[model samples]
Target: MHPDDLSAAAEVHRLAFVRQKQSEQWLASTLAAFPRFLCFVAEEAGQVLGFILWAQKSGFRDQAVLELDQLAVLPAAQGRGIGRRLIVQSLPLVREQLVRQGSSLKHVIVNTRADNHAQKLYRDTLGAQVEATIRDLYSADEVFMVARQVDEGARGR
Candidate 1:
């Protein structure tokens, strides 16, 4: 995503989680720290519907874990397949990045509220399985989900 998209992207995040808005500053910092190659924004005809931000972390396994740091769609645009598309379109690019770096992708992970309906999106779109739940982790119990040993080819698409 480009810096120009920050305001709209921040608005999408704010509207997506009304009570727990993520500041534009935080989003800007994340965008700056992670290359735009690892970020995907859903847009059409000059409007941004949503975005997905991912980051890579090293693990004990000889590969890296790709974590979904944030994924959100404007409340007005929800349930229109934007979330699913964001994930489906991201994996091959993610795998390409890993391959370009001569590294392997071990898993793709995400953490969300235990009761979040988006959990199903993660599971259905990315083949993620709930690994654990940490109670009261952040305003609510949080569920940790991971897709282990991902195929070089995308499956959830």
Candidate 2:
């Protein structure tokens, strides 16, 4: 996603995640600061519909993991599998970047409200399994999930 889409992307988050509202300026600047962040937007005829942003962790090298930093789909765009498409489409790009760095994509991680039904979506779409839980991590319990895609390579650690 480019800086031009930040405002619309922020609007999507505000509408989709009614519980959280972040300034578009902050979101755009934060994304800019993360060179390794991979962001994608679902667009139609020049209008933004949704977006997903992921960033590498653990120093972005061997054994590094990816965190789904944020995802949002416009209220009108939900229930249409936009989120699923974002993940599916971003994987090959992520893999290409890792290969370019001579590194491997080690794991995929995401966090969400423990009671949220979207857990199923993350599990089914991303192969992520709840690996940890923290009470009152936010307004409710938060779950950290992982899809262990590079277990053999990760074993080096």
Candidate 3:
């Protein structure tokens, strides 16, 4: 996504995540980091329908990890698998980078508001696990539910 896409991206975020604060400059700066940071926009006929932002980081245990920073789909675009496509398209790029760096990436991790319907989509449809509960972290009424991708090779456990 281009720098100009930030405003549209932020609008998508606003529609998906009510309390989150995001700025155009922040998105631009993030995109400046490019390959180190993965960002994607779902668009049709020049209008953005959704966007996702994520980063690659190395765990202290020496494992490569993809942290899904934010994912937002326009309300009108929901249920079309746009969110899934963004994730699916990005994961291989993240894995390829990890392999090039000689690190094993066991899973992709994301955290969402505990009560959000998106959590159900992640768990039941995407097959993510509830790794942990971060209590009262984001807000007094909000709980963070962590999820991890369980790919076949990472399954046994």
lDDT of each: 0.81, 0.78, 0.68
The ten-residue window of minimal lDDT in model 3 covers 148-157
| Top lDDT hit | 1
Candidate 1 vs candidate 2: which has greater lDDT?
1
Candidate 1 on 1-157: residue-level lDDT in tens?
8899988888887887677755587678888875433777899888989999888865323487889888999888887998888888887887777777777788888999999999888877778899999999888999999988766665554
**TM per candidate:** 0.89, 0.88, 0.76
Q: In model 3, what is the error at residue 28, expressed in angstroms?
A: 2.0
Residue 61 accuracy (lDDT) in model 3:
30
lDDT over C-alpha atoms for residue 35 of model 3: 62
Model 3 regions more than 4 Å off: 59-62, 100-104, 124-126, 140-149, 152-157
lDDT of 2 at 117: 80
Clashes by residue pair, model 2: none
For residues 1-157, what per-residue lDDT tens digits would candidate 3 score against the true structure? 7777888987887777676666566677788886667788888899999887877765323475666777888999898987777766655665666677676565566777677666665554345766667767675433333445446332211
Give candidate 2 misplaced runs (Cα > 4 Å): 150-157
Over 22-140, each residue of candidate 2 has an lDDT whose tens digit, in order, gives 65865686678655787788998898999888888868677568888777788888888878888777777777777888777778899999998878878777778999999998899
**Could you tally the backbone clashes for each prediction?**
0, 0, 0
